[model samples]
Target: MSGRPPGAKSVDQLLEEARSRITRVTPEDAVSRMADGAVLVDIRPQSQREADGEVPGALVVERNHLEWRFDPESDARLPQATGYDVDVVVLCQEGYTSSLAADALRSLGLTRAGDVVGGHRAWVAAGLPTTGGPAT
Candidate 1:
């Protein structure tokens, strides 16, 4: 045995489970949805954003504060987090963390939560609009 608990799941397993709970969007699709008022939440850290650039107008909530900032019922929630029906599309450096973050949002009753497939790298690859250097 690898010494994990009886019911333990690997990171890959957790990621797979998270992805299954929501519909991931491509960079193009995410932009379209953004135009239609979807909230594009960027959860990358400052260092990553500094290196990879940022999505113009995307909410810059770092990963650590995501749950508090987006949780509708939380007192610390953002003004836009009015309810559970909000369309939240989370983005990370490479898509892995975003999937987990979106899953966490869903657990908080943000039923419309999802992530950008392939994350910032894909966005840069697709030539999507950004305000800084290309995603690394």
Candidate 2:
């Protein structure tokens, strides 16, 4: 049997859908948003994060726990607890996962949720600063 369910689209289709639903921003736009107080959520796994470094002020939240922590009703694990109303931008190793993560946030009622267009790769490619380890 194939991995796809009945009536389900292929990975390409899913990606296209995610792209349509997601609001993409460049690293420069992301910088402006961060300066203006938007929360940048890094959803890349800990291992990848360590290897690739991180954006200077990004919040490290594993992808699995993101919805609960940012949902407002639930007590957030992070020091900075945020509600769904917060302006949030999700990032991953590449642009793909961020779009999915951003869509999930929107489902949780974050109207302003979005993702970095090219994620950390693009950020690094654009010459943005990255921290050596997990954010403190």
Q: Which run of 10 residues does model 1 get worst, by summed lDDT?
A: 127-136
Candidate 2: residue 57 lDDT (0-100): 91
Candidate 1: C-alpha lDDT:
0.94
Clashes of 1: 0
- In order of appearance, the predictions have TM-scores of 0.95, 0.88
- On a 0 to 100 scale, what is the lDDT of residue 73 in model 2? 73
* Candidate 1 local Cα displacement, residue 83, angstroms: 0.4
Steric clash pairs (candidate 2): none
The residue ranges of model 2 lying beyond 4 angstroms of the native Cα positions read 2-5, 77-81, 133-136
Q: How does each model score on lDDT?
A: 0.94, 0.84
Q: Which candidate number would show the highest TM-score if scored against the true structure? A: 1
lDDT at position 11, candidate 2: 75
Candidate 2 is scored at a TM of 0.88
